[model samples]
Target chain A: MDPARRLGPAQIDVVAQLGVSTVLLGGIYALVSVGLTLIFGIMRVVNFAHGEFLMLGMYVAFWAYTLLALDPYVVLFVSIPLFFGIGVLTYVLVMRGVIHASHNVQIFTTVGLSTALQNAALVAWTGDYRTVRPWHSAVVIRALGMAFNLSQVVAFAIAVALTLVLFAFMKWTHTGRVMRATAQDHDAATLMGIDTDKVYRLTFAIGIACVGAAGVLVSPLYAAYPTAGLQFVLLAYVVVVLGGLGDMLGAMLGSLIVAAVEVVGSYFFGVAWKEVFYFVLFIAVLVLRPAGLFGQRGAETLGV
Target chain B: MPALAPGRWVAVALFGIVALVPAGVRDAYLLDSVILILLWGALSAAWNVAGGYAGQVSLGHAAFFGIGAYSAALMTARFQQSPWLGLMLGVALSIVAGGVIGYLSNRLRGPYFALSTIAFSQVLLIVASRWRGFTAGSEGIPVPFRPGFWTLGLGHVAWVYLALGVAVLYYGVAIWLETSRVGYQLAGVREDEDAAEALGIASRRLKVYAVTLSAAMTSVVGTFWAQYVGFVDPFYVFSIDLSVRFALNTIIGGIGTGLGPFLGSLLITSLETYLRATFSGMKTGFAGIYLVIYGTALILVVRFVPEGLTGLAARLRVRSSRAHA
Candidate 1:
C-alpha cells in the first residue's frame, strides 16, 4: 500500500486498539436499534419517541443514584419495570388512538411525546450531564496484541446476550410467536384471536425495557444528560432504516455499518466530517437500495 | 373575493382590540410581551402550512426562521441595506431552501421525512456555529438600529406595531391558502397520498409548494425577529425549542383548521408569557412543566378533540343551528 494509505507500526497499533472499541460500540447500537425495530415490526408505527424513553430511563437511574445512592446497575431492577409500565401506559393512552388515526396523527402524537419528555427532563434535571462514575479505573484487556476497555467489553457482552435472548424468545416462545404473527399480519392475527392489543402493549413495553436496560449498562461508560439520548436516537434511526426497517438482523448489521462509518470517518477526516459522510451514506443507500441491505420487500415504502 | 365568515368577524374584532394594545398600554414591558405573542402567533401560523395543511410535520422549522433572521441581520448590519429589502431576500432564500428539501423528502414516509428536515436544519446550525467569520460563532453579532422610517428599528412602538401588521397579513394569507383549491389538494394529499395522486392531484408538487410558501412566510418573521432583538445568535435562532413551540401552538389551537393556529398561538403564547413572568428564577423547570402540560394536552386533544379548539367551535355552531331548526 502507498505510504498515505498504508498503516505504519504506530498507526497499526492505534487501529487495533480502535477496532474492538468500535465493534463494542456497534454492538450497543445494535441493541438500541433492535428495540426500535421490534416496535416498528409489531405496530408498523415508527416510534419517534423511542429515544426519549432512553432519556427517561437514564433519569430514573440518575435519581436512583442521587436519592437512594443505589448503584446504577442495581437500579435496573426498578428502571426496567418502571419504564415498561410507562411504555404500556403510552400504548394504552396514546398509541391505541393514534394507530387508527391518520399518519399525521401518528407522527404528531409520538413527536409530541418525545418533545414533552425531553422538555420535562430539561425542566427537571436542568440540562446537566451526570454519570455514576466507574467503580474502578478504566481498565483494558489485551488479546492478540489488541486492547479493549472493561466497560466496552461488559456492555458488548450484555448487548450480545440480550440480543440472543430476544432472538430466541421471538423464535421459540409462544408469546413471541404470537408477537411475530401479529407483526407479519395484524388482521390475520386478529382473525386467529391472537390479541394484538396485548401484543402491541407488550411489544412496546419490551422495547422500552430493552432501552432502559441498555441505559443502565452504558451509564458507566458515558455521562447522562437531559439531551444525551438525542445522538443515539439519531443513530438508531440510521440503523433501523439502514438495517431495513422492521428487520431484526438487518438492524444489527446496520448498526455495525453506521458505527463503522462514524468511527472510521471520524478517524480519517475529523469529527465534523462524520455527519457529512453519514448523510451521504444515508442518501446513497436510500437511492440505491430503498428497502435497506436486508430489508423485506414492500416494507420500506410509506403507507400513506 | 369571498366575504369573511360571520364567525370570523368575531376574530376580526379580537384583532382590532389587539391592534390598539400598544396605544392603550403605556408600559414598554407590556408592549414587548404583546409583540412576542404576535410574533409567535405568526410563526405558528406559517408552520401550519407545511405541517398542519400538508401533513408533513417538520420538527426543525427553526432552521428557516434562523436563516431568515441571520440573512437580514447580515445584510442590514454589513451593508446598511433597507431591512424591508433584506426581509424580502430572506424570504426568497427560505423558499428556495424549503422547496429543495421538501422535494427531496416528498416521497418518503412521515418519520423519515421529519428526520431529513431535522438533519438539514441541524447541518445548517452546525455550519452557522462553526463558520464563525460569517455567523460570529457563539459570541453572536449584534446589530444596532440606525433608525430610519424603513430601516427596521429597535426600541420603538411603531416598529412593533409594524411587525404586528406584517404578522397579521401573513395570518390572513395563510387563512386564504387554507380555503383555496390548492389547499384542498394539499389536504387531500395529506389524508391519502395515493388516492390524491390517483385523482391527478400531483401531491409531490403541491407538497413542495406548501413547504416553500410556508418557509417564505416563516423567513419573513425571522427578519422581523432580527430587527426586534437587533442581534443574531445561533443558539436562539436555531434552537429546536422554537420548532417545538411552533408545533405546540398549531396543535393546541386546532390543527388543520384555518383559525386553529390563531387560537392556539394566542392561548399557548400567553400561557408561556405568564409562566415566564410568574416563575422568575425557576424558568427552566417551569418551562419543562409547561411542556409536560402541553404534551399531555396534545395527546388528550388528539384522542378526544383532534380537530382542536376550532373543531370544537364548529361542533358547537352546528349543534346550535340544529337546535334552532
Candidate 2:
C-alpha cells in the first residue's frame, strides 16, 4: 500500500474504536428492533410501546439492583417472564380487539397504552433518571487499543446471543414454525389447524420478552427514566424500517448500518446532526423503499 | 350549506357558550385554562383536516406548529417585525412544508405515514434545540408584551376572543370541508384510495390539499399561541406530545366527523385542567397523575368508543329515535 494511502496507527485505532462502539450500539438496537420487527411480522401490528417495555425492564432491573442488591443481569430472569405475562395480558385485553380493527384504532390503542405506561412511570418514578451501577460497570475492557465497559460488553454479548437463540428457535422450534406460518398467511395457518390466535399471542409474548431482556441488558448502559424509551424506540423504528420492517435479519443489518451512520456522523457532524441524518434517512427509506431491504413485497401495505 | 345535523347544532352551541366564558369567569387562571382549550381545540381541528378526513394520522404536526411559533417569535424578537407579517410568513412556510410532507407521504398509509411524520417532526425538534445561534435554542425567545391591535391583543378577554375567533375559523373550515365537493373527494380518498382514484377523485392532489390547508390553519394558531404565551421554546412547540395531543383530541372527539375534534378537545382539555389543578401539590407518582388519567381515558375511548364522544352521542340519538319510531 502507498504510504500516503495507508492510515496511521492512531487513525486505525479511531476506526476500530468507532467500529466496536458501533457494533455495541448496534447490538442493543438489534435486540430492540428484532422484537419490534417480529411483532409487526407476525401480528402485522406495530408495538408502539416497545420502548416502554424496555423502560419497564430497566426499571425492574434498577429496582432489583437497588432494593435487593442483586446484579442487574440477574433481573433478566425476573423481567423475561414478567414481561411475557404482561405481553400476553396486553394482547388479550388490548391487541385482540384491534387485531381486526382499523389501522387508526390499532395505532392509537398502542399509542394510548404507551402514553399511559410512560406517564404511569413518570408518576411512579417522578421523572427521575435512575442508573444501575453494577459492580462491574466501572471495569474497562481494553483490547487492541480500544476501551469499553464490561457491562456494555456483556450487554452486547447477551444481545447477540439472544438474537442467535431467537434465530434458532424460529428455524427449529415447532411454536416458532407455527408463528412463522401465521405470519406468512393467517388464514392458511388457521385452516391448517395451526391455532393462529395462540400463535399470535405467543409471538407477541416472545417479542415482549425479547425487548424486556434487552431492556435489562440496557439498564447499566443507559439511564432509566420515564421517557428514556422514547429515543431508543425511534431509533428502533429507523433500524427496523431500514432493515425492512418485520425482517429479523434485516433488523440486525439495519441496526449496524444505522449505528454506523450515527456514530460516524456524530464524529463528523456533532450529535444533533447524527439524529437529523438518521431521521432523514428514515424518511428516505419510507419514501423510496417502503417494503424495506429484507421485507416482502406487500409488507409495507399489509392489511391495507 | 348542508342540513344542520344534531352534532352541528351542538357544536354551534358549544362554541357560543365557550365564546362567552371570559365574560362569566373573571379569574385570570380560569381564563388561561379556557384559552388553552380554545387554542388546543383549534389545533385539533386543524389536525383533523389531514388526519381525520384524509386519514393521514400524522404524529409530527409539532413541526408545523413550531415553524409558525418560531417564525413569528424570531420575527418579533430578532427582526423587529409585526406579528401579522410573521403570521403571513408562517402560513406560507407551513403551506410549503405541508405540501412537501403531503407529497412525500402521499402513498404512505397507516403506521408508515404516522412514523414518517414523527421522524420529520424529530428532525425539526433536534434542529430547533441544537441551532442555538439561530433559534436561541431551548432558552427560548421572549416576545415583548406589546399590547396593541398590531401586537394582536390587549387583555385576557381580548385573548379569549382571539382564541375563540381562531377556533371558530377552524370550525368553519371543518364545516366547509364536510359540506364542500373537495371535502367529499377527501372523504372518498380516506375511505378507499383505490376506489376513489378509480373514480378520478385525484387522491394525491386532495390529500396534499388537506394537509396544506391543515398546516396553514395549524400555523395560524401557532402564531396566536406564540403571541399568547409571549415566549417561544423549541420543546414546547416541537414536542411529539403536542402532535399526539392533537391526534388524541381529534380521535377522542370523533375523527372524520369534523365536529368531533372540538368536542374531544373540550372534554379532554377540561379533564386535563381539572386533573392538573387537583394534583398540583402532589409529589412522586402524583406528578403525572393528569397524564395517567388522560392516557387511560384515551385507551378506554379508543377501545370502547372508537367513533369518539360525538360518535357515541350520534349513536345514542339514533337509538332514541328508533325507540320513538
Candidate 3:
C-alpha cells in the first residue's frame, strides 16, 4: 500500500479496533433487522412500531433490573417470552385488522401503533435515559493488539449465537418450514393445510422476540429511553432494505455493511455525517435497485 | 360561482363565527391556541394534497417546512427583507425541494416512498444543524419582532386573521383539486398507478405537481409559523414529529375529503389544549400523556374509522336521508 494510504502500527491498531467494534455493532444491527425483515418477508407488512418493541424490551430489562435487582443478561430470558407474547397480542388485536387493508392503511396502522407505543412509554417512563451499569459494562479486554469493551463483546457473542439458532430453527424445524412456506406463498401454504394466520402470528412473535434479545444485549451499551428505538429502528430499516427486504441472510450481511459504513464513515467524515452518508446510500440503492441485494424479483411491488 | 348551497351558507356562517373569535375572546392564550389550530389545519390540508389525493405519503414534509422556515427567517434576519417577499422565496425553495424529492422517490411505492422522505428529512436536519453559518446551527435564528402590518407584527388578532386567511386559501385549493380534472388524474394514479399510466395519465408528472403544490402550501404555512412564533430552530422546524402531526391530523379528520384536515386539526388542537389545561399541574410526565392519547386515538381511528370524522359524518347524513325516505 502507498505510505499515504498505508496505516502505521498505531493507526492499524485503531483500524483493527474499529473493525471489531463495527462487527459487534453489526451483530446487534443484524439481530434488530432480522426480526423486522422476517415480519416484512412473511407478512408483507412493515412493522413501523418494531423499534418501539425494542424499546419495550429495554424497559422490561430496566424494570427487572431496578425492581428485582436482576442482571440484564438474566432478564433477557423473561423479556424475550414477554415480548413474544406482546407481539402475538399485537397481531391478534391490531395486525389482523389491517392485514387485508390498502397499502396506505397498513402503513399508517403501524405508524400509529409506533406513535402510540413510543408516547405510552414516554408517559410511563418519563423519557429518562436509564442504563444498566453491570460491573462488566466498563470492563475492557485487550486482544490482538486492540482493546474491546467486555459488554460489547458479550452482546456480540449472544447476538451471533441467537442468529445462528434462529437460522437453524428456520432450516430444520417443521414449524419453521411451515412459516417459510407461508412466507413464500400464503395461498399455497393455506392449500397445503398450513394455518397461515397462525404462522404469521408465530413469525411476528419470533421477530419481536429477536428484538427483545437485542434490547437485552444492548441495554448495557445504550440507554433506555422513549425515543431510544427511533435511531436503531431507522438503521434497521436501512439494514433490512440494503440486505434485500425480507432476506435473513441478506439482512445479516447488510447489517455488517451498514455498521462498517457507520464506523468507517464516522472515522473519516466525522460522526455527524455518518447518517447522511448512509441515508444517501439508502436513497441511491432504492432509486437504482428497488429489489435489494437478496430480495426476490418484484418484491418491491409485492404488497402494492 | 353558481348559487351557493345551504351547506356553503353553513360553512360561511362557521367562517364568520371564526373571524369574530378574536373580538369575542381577548385571552391571549385562547387566541394563540386558535391560531395554532388554524396553522395545523392549513398544514394538514397541504399534506392532504399529496398524501390523501395523490397517495404519496411523505413522512419527511418537515424538510420542506423547515426549509421554508429557515429561508424566511434568514432572509428577514440577514438581508432585512420584507417577510412577504421572504415568504414567497421560501415557498419557491420548498416547491423545488419537493419537486426533487418527488422526482427521485416517485419510483418507490407506498412505504418505500415514505422511508425515502424520512431519510431526506433526516439529511436536511443534519445539514441544518451542522451548517451553522447559514442556519445559526441549533441555536436558531430569531425573526426580529417588527410589529407592523407589512412586517406581520400586527398583534395576535392580526395573526389569527392571517392564519385563517391562509387556512381558507389552502382549503380552497384542496377543494378545487378535489373537484378538478387534475384531481381525477391524481385519484386515478392513487387508485392504480400501472392502470393510470397505461391510461396515459403521466403518473410521475401528476405526482410531482401534487407534491410541489403541497410543499409550496406547507411552506407558506411554515413562513407564517416563523412570523407567528418570531423564532426558528432546526429541531422544531424539521422535526419528524411535525410531519407525523400533519399526517395524524389529516387521517383523523378524514383523508381525501375537502373538510377532513380542517376538522382533524380542530379536534386534535382542542383535545391537546384541553389535556394541557387539565394536566397543567401534574408532575408525573402528564405533559406527554396527550401524545399517548393521540397515538392510541390514531390506531383506533385507522382501525375502526379509517375514513375518519368526515366519513362518519357522511355516513350519518346518508343514514338520516334514508330514514326520512
Off by over 4 Å in 3: A1-7, B1-10
In order of appearance, the predictions have TM-scores of 0.92, 0.97, 0.96
Give, for candidate 2 chain A, the lowest lDDT window spanning 10 residues: A295-304
Q: Pick the candidate with the highest lDDT.
A: 2
Per-residue lDDT of candidate 1, residues A1-304 (tens digit): 6897566777787787667667888899988788898998788788878888877777777678778888766777777788788888988877987786766677778877887888788787787788766553177788877777776787788888888899899989999999999988889999999988889999998998888777877777777887777777778878887888788988888988988898888888878667666666775665466567887554445552
Positional deviation of residue B286's Cα in model 3 after best superposition, in angstroms: 1.1
lDDT of 2: 0.87
Model 2: colliding residue pairs: A123-B285
Residue B142, model 3: lDDT of 90
- What lDDT does each candidate get? 0.79, 0.87, 0.86
Model 1: fraction of native contacts: 0.43
Candidate no. 1 TM-score: 0.92
User: How would you encode candidate 1's per-residue C-alpha lDDT over B1-325 as one tens digit per residue?
Assistant: 8887754775687678778877778888777777877788788888998888888788789989998888888888777788788888888889789887677556566666776676676667767776777777777768768867688765657856776786678767766766788878888998888899999999889889888888988898898888887888887787766787788788878776666777888798777777766664666566567777787777777778888888888899999999999
> How many residue pairs clash in each candidate at the backbone level?
1, 1, 0
For residues A46-155, could you state the per-residue lDDT of candidate 3 as single tens digits? Answer: 88889998888888888888899988889888888888998899999989888878778888888888888888888788877999888888998989998888989998
Instruction: Rate residue B107 of model 2 by lDDT.
Output: 58
Ranking by lDDT: 2, 3, 1
What does each candidate score in C-alpha RMSD? Answer: 2.7, 1.9, 1.9
Ranking by TM-score: 2, 3, 1
Candidate 3 scores an iRMS of: 1.6
Clashing pairs in 3: none
